[model samples]
Target: MDETTLKENKINQQASTTEHEEFHTQYTTLNLGPTHPATHGIFQNILTMDGEIIIDSEQTCGYIHRAFEKIAERRPFYQITTLTDRLNYCSSPINNMGWHMTVEKLIGVEIPKRAQYMRVIIMELARISDHIVCNTVIGVDTGALTGFTYLFQWREKIYDIFEHICGARLTTNIGRIGGLERDFSPEVYKRINAFLAEFPKAFTEFCTLLERNRIFFDRTAKTGPISAERALNYGFTGPNLRAAGVDYDVRVADPYSSYEDFEFQIPIGVSGDTYDRFMVRQEEMWQSLKIIRQALDNMPQGKHFADVPEFYLPPKEDVYHNMEALIWHFKIVMGESDVPKGEVYHAVEGANGELGFYLVSDGGRTPYKLHFRRPCFIFYQAYPEMIRGGMLSDAIVTLSSLNVIAGELDA
Candidate 1:
């Protein structure tokens, strides 16, 4: 090694020694993931525990690192949308929108009003699905698989809505930088409307079946509680942070894609514990329904893409007859269109927490850097804190309540 490399290594070693001296605690260490089924993805957590209470912890990752930023650097603007779907695959559309919106902002694309409303409707639908999966997993971890079944069935219906929209489910690359690939099919709308009508009955059944169970409450209530002050200090947001009694939501605090046009309530909890987090998601589902209803009520009439013929393709008829239209269509489809040079960070309300995309552009057809601010990643930081001093059972409830997805967390 060169002198510079040797010097850097020495500095790192000294830093490690200093940290160990200052932060040392008498506790046993445990490695919790990287293959654990309940980890949700490829994640490994190092825990520092003093018998039943945690003293400190460190989270180690990169087990499933595909170097997403490096991959995005090689893919075209449109191609990158598919990759974003895997970032937080449970709410793939939301991830898809965040990536596209940053690119759209860079290129100064003003999407049509119709497309904006469409994005809002589908995004809210995805949020509902994401939360249901998370909340149900909480039940499953706590030994209430019945709630998991009911909730999973409802989420399956939501996935059907996705399949109807784009002929694909899970990794739905349904949005674009300029606009959408197409409008929702009549059948898509009919199914969503039908699902909306039946949803209340299902939600009521979910509540009746799970929420009031004495055994369930005994497991969840007041167990593994974190103070509201500590949660804010930890950079938490979305339903998890809101459950700590701070009514901050990305959709309301920082509205995007016409979210401000819709009215909805933000749910909060007095105790920053597992049960409160569960309650927050359950109530937010109701608020999401309110958002969807309002967006549907005020749905408008207009073109899907704004009239950017170069970036947004013209109609097929125009493409066939007009030379300029043909050239532009070919350019966009071939990923040769010149997107602007800049960078922007955008986040939406994802199921687990704040799902953000920090994107950089080089005025080329492809992105320069793509980073996801995954909520599960930070929730893992509080793992030792959450399960410390609580029973081993509390560890299960705490993990489930955080709603960490290994795919998302590892991403």
Candidate 2:
């Protein structure tokens, strides 16, 4: 009787265990990214999925981490602008300007009014280019490819403006510690004006295609919705935070780089969904256009750069002709230029959010320690939470809307 009872109990227990395993195995573990196209970056997400719905997600960064902060510590102040260029490669000028502004603050060099205005124009153009990429990508994620192709031409025109100014596109190391490396050339102004005249009409057409399109609205309107309180709690900023209905723009609140001189409205959204993010960025591009136009119209008549020979690089002609200018150029290039013993933090509204530079200098040629407050890195902390319980497609669209550039995120 004991042997029969024990055998029966063992059989029942094995069957129960097998059933449990089969039931649990129905929920698959899926790797959403690391090299996936929808990721839009080298970001990796390990998603726990029940069919197509994400039950949970885990994000892994640092895949493309070049140790930018550590690199900054080794590089001189002026040379570090190149590092900033790689931080947010989508809008490298903004990163360039932000780093330059931080160094300027440390050196106590007051930039000229014209230089400030020029910086504003470049930064706003960068902003517009960045938003164009983000919004168009959102459209593409939603299966609307027309807007992306249509607007990318304008983005190239903006890049042409950058190329005319700095002779570099994508990762443009455009500005200097005191101000821009040089003033905008006539060709630069011409390209900028042409872009300004053409982009608005094209952008309006792009908006008309998507803003009210039923498929786009259905895909984005309520998907990945986050409340204002939650977004602020997660340290969200830029269009993402503005999409959550918080109007905390660094330009308006902190007013750096003569932003106070410009008149522009901060566009805010209500639901903090993908659609809100897209719309907010669309509006931001318009506001950025307004700022750019004003900056160009009221550009002061003065030197292109501040008269800080110690910090600013001398003209190439001067460097070639004058021994003193050559010496200064060598000192500036070789990290021999003196930096003050102080700590300074400067933030600018980057295309993604507030790009901040925390510089600590012990009066050394190189920074004692440099820390970058990258907004993509900060906002990415909430990705798993944002995507949990959402469909995989929604996650893709939400990510596109967030515009989490890997350079910015991993740096």
Candidate 3:
């Protein structure tokens, strides 16, 4: 009686367990973000889930759309730099410099080598700042919060350098169309050197915390992987494209702002997953450091701003004390200065990817049409595809590693 009764009960128990598992295999819809912290931006994903696995997803953008391209059509060339600041606010200086370079190309104003080197230094710092926020946030999403808080201090130091240079931190209207509005002060150099010297130690610590962590690798290594062909077809650039094993860095492919002068390597990855994205950003921060050091050491000597007095604002002291300076300042600020009718496109190696500006001028105070090739907007198109078969948690880490800034995406 014992053996037969036990066998019958065991069979019944197994059947009940199977029934329970099937009952719980239900699907639900989830709103991943728009205001969700894991999103890291003002974008929303409508996710269809089977338990924790993301089955399908739809992305909603334009929550922060400020119509940047349309705004550029109305504002004068000089006024447009402020709008760029709002794009990739994490690395606004790169947007500022990219916009300025676009106008310079249109007007045929050659930036001095010194000014180019200065721009390079600032842009590289912005790159470091951008990568820091991305890589550390990737850690945060992976449940390692300490690294984010620890490395944020270095981000503040980078912001301090920005504040010193442009008198603003987050949205730095850093350079003018022809060149920088002002040269870097000795104090700014001091801050940069200090950052360069100290950041490596903290960065090393940050990497040590997560790079080889078993949990982190398990969560991120193969999650949200995309093939190189698909990534490139989607117009991927910057680290996102690089993570797919294509080494197409705009700074290397089409050098601008004297990026040709400084030597640095493009960081690449093979899997195009969250882990690769994080690793690529980590390596890029190091490359940015290398570029900054080279620019500082081999800086050229020349005026920070070009000789285009008509377009560039006059010195504040001169505006107050000299009549001609006052007139030029008025003309430049009021958008009364004329620009030659032409079309031009300029791109820079932005923190996200390729930050490009395509300008068409009608020989007017404002551009006839201006378009920004914001990398965040372009790469975000690949999000649903990337996260399609991944888990909900992997989606968060993938988004963090992509570094899709709302301002940039919506702009």
Give one digit per residue, the lDDT tens place, for model 1 in 182-202. Answer: 788899889889888998798
lDDT of 2 by residue, 1-411 (tens): 563355445545554676645665455567777999887889888776768988667788899999888887888888888888898899999999998888888889899999999999999999998998999999999998899999999999998898999899898999888888778888888888888888889988998999999988999999888899999999999999999999999999999889999899999999999999999999999999999999989989998898888888899999999999999999888889888899999999999899898889999889999999999999988888888899999999989888899998988
| Tens digits of per-residue lDDT for model 3, 1-411 | 463355445545554666645665544667777798678779888776767887667788999888888888899889999999999999999999999888888888897899999998999889899888988898899899999999999999999999999899998999887888788999999999999899999999888989999998998999888899999999999999999999999898998888888788888999898899899999999989999999989988878989999888888999999999999999998999989999998998899999889899999999999999999999899998998877788888888888999999999
Off by over 4 Å in 2: 1-25
Taking all chains together, the TM-score of candidate 2 against the true structure is 0.94
Ranking under TM-score, best-scoring first?
Answer: 2, 3, 1
Residue 356 in candidate 2, Cα distance off native in Å: 0.8
Give the range of the ten consecutive residues with the poorest summed lDDT in model 3.
3-12
